[model samples]
Target chain A: MLETLNQTTFLHTVVAIGSFTIFTIGLVGVLSKKNLFKIFLSLSIVESSLFLFFIGSHFEVGKAAPIVADGIKLFDGHMVDPVPQAMILTTIVIGVAVLALSLTFVVNYYRLSGNIDIDKMDELGEVQ
Target chain B: MFNFEITALGNMFFGLTVLVFVSLFFVPNKHRSVTLYSLLFASLACIFYASDLITLFIGWEIMGWSSYFLIAKTADKQTLQKYIVFNIGGAFTLLGAIILIYGACGSFVYSELDFSAVPSGQVTAITILLLLTLFVKSGIMPFHYWVVDSYSQSNDLFSAVLSAIISKTGVFAFILIFFQIITVQYLQTPILEVVAWLGVLTSIIATFKAINEDEAKRLLAYSSIAQVGYIVTILSIMGSLSLEAALYHTVIHTFVKLLLFINVAAIIYVSKQHRFSTLGGLLYKYPLNFILLVVGIISLAGMPPLGGFSSKFLIYTALLEEHKGLLLAAVLFSSASAFLYCYKLVYGIYLGQPTNPKTEAYPRIPLRFYVPQILGAVILITLGTIPGVIVPMFNGILGSVGFEPVLYRGVFVLGSDFASFNGGVVIGAFGLIFVLILLFFVRLKNRSVKPKDRLDISYCGEVPRADVNLHYGYGMGRELSRIGLIKMILSRSSHALWQRVSTLFGDLSGITQKLYTLSAQNMGLVIFAFFTILLYMGVK
Candidate 1:
């Protein structure tokens, strides 16, 4: 039973369900948030779910990380596709940068307007 | 990483860019203005020489922002906002069209486009998108709300550049994209017909608006729109002769606007006034400037013995050749009506009695102002005397753009298969008649009696006071607005449609903002519901 659980299809299904669950949680937080900080955090959470989906879908039951090391001497099918993993790393860096910048903006905005709740923020002076 | 190629069409516009820039340099501007002008010139060159759509787009963006900053130098916040918003919208539409073409052809290079292989529907979509971009840039009808404000509000000399050279970039893009890349064979007839009608209607409306205007620069701005409208109309015909006509008009208009705007700028510089109500009796004070303005207006009105008439003649013959009788008639109507605003322009500033006592004390115009005016006048006169001087250049442009060469017998004659005229003969006849009239007037000068006092004329058996109102310039075109046709045209505003569209976008953003204003937990719940819906669909 344990060996059967190692099947590629089963693993893919598990990864899909797990990422979907995280994505839903993050999405809900984002859609309901009034605080600027919390909304951004929720957006990052949603982004992480996308990262998991991309990397996990490319995984095989027996494949190792793309790195060549002690047991793996040559590049072959034994290593999972490296492109998606590399792309995810880049995405993670960009995600961190964006989050930091947004948080700084939120801080500045709070200092100026004395409000962090998006509902109370009306810098553009739009009516109702 | 970028490709640049010089086609004949590109060369023609690039030559115009150089000409206008050189003329602008002599206008005595600030260092910052000069820098911006150079930047604009370079960007225009980039656009004209671009061999690929991406390069063209980059140049287009630079041109837009440079002009924005240039206009921002003298314009108010609202006008700047309008200019940026509309120009950015136009740029985005152009980008969308370029992307669509790239998607279909797998390349952005002009020579690589394979419209023949693409579906007709996609081609039409791309053409419409590109046309939308050109329409906005060229200030065609509904998209023209930003033009008058920007032209009126910008620095005087720069306004000349905007009207003279910057506007033609749109015409350049239209010729390049529609004629070269898309090719006329693939264009649907109905679409061209629609474009033709749009051009004519814009001219008619803009002519009336020009007549109704009180400000000098604003009137000229509207006149610019009307003049470009004829070019657009002729271009829609897409015949060999029509293209030549369009090109000829483009050259004539560039010189005319440059001369007129600078002439107006000189007046404003000396008098510190812009409204016709404040400016009058300036002809005697600045006789040379007055003469320059007359030349500009006569060319603008397409009167005989000027370069404008030659282009107008070509346009009429082109339309007639195509058997577009109704279009030709409408064009003629607008041309005839243009005379009213042209008269108002001259009469309001130069021919009428002084409206204010301060008119006599205004400073003399600087010598530098005459440089560009003199250059423009000489070019206009030469083109008028021998219109065929530019025909060879236009023929080369046509050849590079893959159109058949227009017919011409020599350097003095211009015509197609249907009709022809000798520019030299027209100018000679006009000159002889003018000289004869002058000689006759000079001969009769000694016999005629002069009035003892200017205000001595009897007004209902009462002498009018020195301060009594006598100037008719301000009210010259006032009755035009009362006409039924003009009244209806004046009642409608293009701004209303654009405002409605903006409000719709605002409503959409408002809805999104509401979603963004909710509590974090509620947002999380909505996201969960969205995810569950997606999962449900995937499972099914």
Candidate 2:
């Protein structure tokens, strides 16, 4: 029991560290970056961390895939929480949709003003 | 849980299936009736089969795409793309929130999901996600950036749909989630109070922005945000009274925005003029719509004896119940200021003298053009006249959320076992007084007060070109702009925050995008990083 408890804690510690690191990297990129394209890309990274954390927290010991093979079970805690995985799947699809849409925005921005820099947007507040 | 009935499934599939096929039909330019018809069918489907979240999402995404294509007609590709991107971003937030809930409970039906089961942290995350999505589409405060740009760029009638039906979906979604799925008490109130404050702040600032905007469509867009801010404020209260208020405001706002956008669209269509400085004296040109728009503006302004006031009345009561003296005062002040811009939208566009009579305006508006707008406007006025007519409907809508049913006796009355405004009495008294004034005015008038052209006033010592360039939209929202502290730094756009951030992003992406331009390298890195992180976690 103690060993299992220690292992669970260790797994959580890894998850906490990894997702936070990924999040930090994205944050730093978003904060420090000067390119519109890179900012959007960094946002994707941040989104990935959120997905990772969600999926990671739901992970438990001794769980097999929820998908029913001949002897496999469904929705048992022995399996990693399917909920977070399913949510991540949906979020991933949505993230792709938003990314494609935003990238198109970048393309249009480039076409209109021939400038891809955010600092170049002069028509909005205080820019001109 | 509501079972995914074949009928419901079929309705959603119709919109989904037609999206690709209809895209082709809309590809050939000038095929408007077909485009409008397809959208109407899809929108109707969305409205009817609102039980399942996933089914609802399909309708929402397809609606977003359909509207984007329609807006492409009036705007250049870039504006259309921005419009689509911003809307899609909001829609994605919603999808994330929905998926979060479904994941939590293993159900997509709105009816069966229980909030108590949602882990506290997940609930907060889900709420924030839902809030962000709705806030963007609702065009509240910082998210108002896309509102003016996209609405102004869309084809005239399409702008009407953009303002009216689309934004209301945000409110509907809020009602579903916040009022229904998530218990507001379990969530944070200070956050909602802040949202309320933001709503009020946006109203004040955007009202000023609207007044100063020279572009006709942009002015209306800002005005739409300001009105939406009021609706947002009411929604934050999360009570039976507030829910009624929010829904009432949502309905009235839909009609009012459609009224204003349709009139503007008709004006743009007829005269090929968009800016107020370039056009004038339209009260006679589009008489029916001008009156209709006036009714909407008055309703929007929360003036009494109109559909606007009924909803606005509820918002005020909700605020008072909270007993936030300052916030209530602010709400009252912002709405009072709303009247000024309401005046500006009407007088500047319709009542003022035309710069030159010879300047050609668009020919008479088509009847089909007026049909939808008139239908919306008429419902708004008729609702105000008989406030109780829709009280039961609101009761039915709110009933799904398990909120206490607000008292309705042909007029909504709030204040449980305490103070309340009897709307019928107040409205009836006002109506009586109005009739008395009309009779007196009729008795006093006749031969002496012959109504003539809207522009009987002097246009001269005349410089027609100077008149055309005159500023009509300046400094309307100035009073409320003083509260600049409300501007959020984290939003996609606010006070040049996004602009500077995007610029920095642009510079960095310029370097990295090239480095990652090859999919092979980028994919390898992504997969390797993904596996490395997963392995590290799994092994630990």
Candidate 3:
């Protein structure tokens, strides 16, 4: 029984490592990407990794989804921590708000300036 | 309806009422004025009676949005967008902090959150977040980008409200942040120390920039930032002396800045110009505005016995007590720089020879212009003479925040020495002496003194020519803005920081566009590699 538990811990560590590597790939894509739409979608991918890590790290052997049903009781030992989940919900909302706002700014900027390449904007150049 | 414990609720509701009615109705200047006046009263009411963080935040958000709409009426939508975004950033930061605290303690009641009860890390986080929000709203360094851009573009009346009352909400927010939510014991780290240092640096740098600013509104914007920097430094000290010093500054800075901005607004209104090059010799015609602005500038310089001096004196004392050696030096340097800009503001635009060939101005201003100036000027003088009345008031404000209330009347009071006076007594004496001299000159009646036109300043080897556009206001103190330290911190252009951020965004988009260049076989290889890595990780 103890050996199985130890093996489970090592497996969890491996999963964590793999997930982190995927996260790095997504981050690299985000940093290197130049298209407005693609950059935003890359950010979405990054958010997904975070959600997976959060939900996955809380997983335990034989544990089930953290919700109540006919058989599953509230606050059962089989369920994961509720606090991180609630926090992630708030984080998701805030993230969405910020993303929407920034995209709107981008859209409006495109509408006004015609060119979205920030490298091209020199309306107010640095004073010597 | 909920039997609210917050007295500020009624006032906030009243402000919203005005905001609603004004937005719906055509509300010509009279209706606008009445609504603005009522909103002003409502804000003042909110200032007095805010109970908890929730109530305070409500009042605070209301003030910002109302002022935003008011300024939006004047500025283009882009300027309005910048204004709204910056303010919302501040509001949301405050909200995030309050929510965080509430989550920790399961309570929204600010009065119940004892500074000693919370973990130090939580306290630190809360204070830092609150400071960042307030600093931005107050237009402190680094976060001061929105100020000059939006302020210069906003309408005159809305700009006045923005300069005077709207900015004070940040001060109000700071009072709560520093005095109520934070304790010196809790701030074991030197966060407040950093804030103090930043404050001094902000003032010094911004003051240097102000001396060289060309636009009247932009100059006032820089000057306002510098003044607020001083107040922020004093508040961060958290001692009784510093807190009182800050509040005194809050009142005085409001009065002096309001007086200056309104007079400048009047100039823009009358002359229909904003650049100094187009303005000169206003003192010859609008003497009341000239006098009020001159006094206002004098107060701004912290000249003895004026409203400016009283608060500045307290600030110097607070610095002395703390023995903030470098900070003190910065304060003195900024104060000295005040002379360059203040002189330029007074002499270049108002006193110097008019450069315009068409030198005649609109000869006079209406009562609307004069009334605001008088109200602002009177408050400056009154606050300077009897700051004793507000000393307890500051203490009361501090007390509400849960910090130790600063005693205003004690022997340790700053700037009480004759050297750092409000200059009220001396100014009065000077006025009397001037009157007596004028009388003597009148009684002798020997030499006739002709009133010279502003365009008639005697130039080299030439008589005063009517065709000469002397252009007295051009290039006054522009060189003073070249202070390397200030230039480094201040946005180099009107669109400096925002432009960079926007560029970075564009570059990001550009880079993202390149990702689709890969072949379908390469993409399959990537997928194969990914699954192989996953398998390897699981087996390991």
Candidate 4:
């Protein structure tokens, strides 16, 4: 059953469903969180779900990592598609950068306005 | 990927306007300002030469930001805010249109946009979006909220460039997008009709606004809108003659604004004043500048023996050729009404007696200030005397853009199937008549009345003091407000419409903001609910 679960179609379906569920949870957290920090973390969670969906769907059972090693004989379908993994790696770095930058903005906002709750933040002077 | 192609239309506009930009270098400005100015020139060149939507967009964005920074140097925060918001909105609309075009054509290249394959409805939608961008850039009614403030607030010399050169970029874009990429055959008829009406309406409204404006630059700014309105209207007609008319008007309006603005800038530079209330009796102090401004306003009013008349005549002829009777009437009305403001512009600054006592103490205007004014004057005079000089160039532009060449009869004459005019005769008759009057005036010098005391003007039982406000410039246009139509036009503002739009956006943003303020548990529940909805949709 475990081996069957690792099959290509089965694994891809499971990853799609699981990552989508994670994305939904993050989306809900982002929608409902009062704290700026929680909202940003929730956004990061959503981004991670996207990365999982990209990388996990490309994985194949019994395939070697896309690296040249003593056991790995040739560069072919025997190795899982490496493009999605490479893309995910770049995406993760960007995600982290964005999250870090946003958090800094949030910190600055908190210091300046003294409120982490987005509802209470009105530095732009918008009418309620 | 980057691609640029040269067309005669681009050459005509860029070649003429670049001279204005190059002339700015002669005017003293900060090094950084010069750098920004050059950047704007390059971006405009990019826009004119761009063969692909991506390149066009990049240039459009650069032009927007560079102009923004240039304006921000002197503009107040509110003015800067208005400029950025409107320009960014225009840029986003342009981006959307480009993306939509790319989706339909599967390529960014203008040459490859095979709209025949796309559905007509989609094409119309894309055209409307593209038009929205052009409308905002051109400062048409409803989208023109930023123009008056930005023009009034920018550095004086840059205001000349803004009105003379930068505004024409929208005209260039209209020619490029509507005529070239989305050829006339593909455009829906009713939409073009609507565009034509919008242009004429903008002109009528802007003319009134211009007349009522006390601030000199703001008046000129409104005049620029009104002038471009005619171009837009003619362009919407999309005939060979109409295109020529639009191009001619574009060229004429550029020089007219350049001369007028720089002339005002010189006055402002000397007197340190921009309002009509404070500026007067400047004719004797700066006679050369005064004459140049007179020439400018004459041409701008489209009176004969000036370059303005040639273009205006061409425009009227084009409208007649199209049998657009109502449009012709409306345009003629606007053109006639323009004479009042033209008179106001001149009388406000040069004709009226000096209002302030310190007017006599203003410093001499620098010689460098006269360079651009002189260049502009020479060009206008040449175009006025030989209006046929640009006909071939206009024809070349038309041919390159795949439009039929307009009929040309002689070196000094321009005509279509309907009517024609001789620029040489117009200028010759006017010059001879003007010289005769001047000679007669000079010959009768002995008949001149003796000069009276400066403060000897008659008053109703009260002698007016030196400090009394005797200048008619301040109240020149005030009585125009008594007219019902003029009163209505002056009272209405586009600001309320834009405010409504922003308020709607604010409300939408308020709802979205709430999503970020919910508790953690509620967020989790919302997430589950969203997931369940997505799953159900997927299953269905």
TM-score, every prediction = 0.79, 0.67, 0.68, 0.78
**lDDT order of candidates, top first:** 1, 4, 2, 3
Local accuracy of candidate 1 as per-residue lDDT tens digits, A6-79: 99888889889999999878876777677888889889998999999888889887887788888777779878
> Across residues B454-515, which tens digit of lDDT does each residue of candidate 1 receive?
46554448877987766666656678768998888887876677679778988999988887
Candidate 2 residue spans exceeding 4 A from truth:
A1-128, B1-44, B360-362, B411-505, B516-540
Error of 2 at B213 (Å): 1.8
Error of 2 at B82 (Å): 2.9
**DockQ sort, best first:** 1, 4, 3, 2
After superposition, candidate 4 runs with Cα above 4 Å error: A1-128, B30-32, B443-455, B459-462, B465-468, B499-540
- The candidate with the higher TM-score, 2 or 4, is 4
Per TM-score, the best of the predicted structures is 1
Candidate 1 lDDT:
0.87
Tell me the RMSD of model 3 versus the true structure. Answer: 14.1
User: What range of 10 consecutive residues in model 1 chain B has the weakest lDDT sum?
Assistant: B451-460
In model 4 chain B, the worst 10-residue window by lDDT is B450-459
Per-residue CA lDDT of candidate 4, range B303-403, in tens? Answer: 98989999999999999999999999999999998998898888889876777668879988888877887888888898889888889898998898899
Over B243-350, each residue of candidate 2 has an lDDT whose tens digit, in order, gives 877877877777777677777777776777787766766776777878887787878888877778778877887777777677778778778867777777787677
Query: Per-residue alpha-carbon lDDT of model 3 for B1-540, expressed as tens digits?
Result: 011243322233234234323332321232265565566556545643565667666766776776766666667765776677778888888888888777666666656666666787887788777887888788888777787777788776556556665666667667665665555677754887888888888888788778777788888888888988998888887777787788778777776776787788778776788888778777778888888997798789987656787788788887888787778888989998898889878876787667664558364666566665676688677656654555655665556445565454432233433223334465576568879998998988778544466544344576655655566457666454475655564446547567677679878877766555444334545776798899999999
What DockQ number belongs to candidate 3?
A: 0.02
| Alpha-carbon lDDT of model 4 | 0.87
lDDT of 4 at B213: 85
Task: Candidate 3: list runs displaced more than 4 Å.
Answer: A1-128, B1-48, B361-363, B398-459, B462-469, B481-491, B506-540
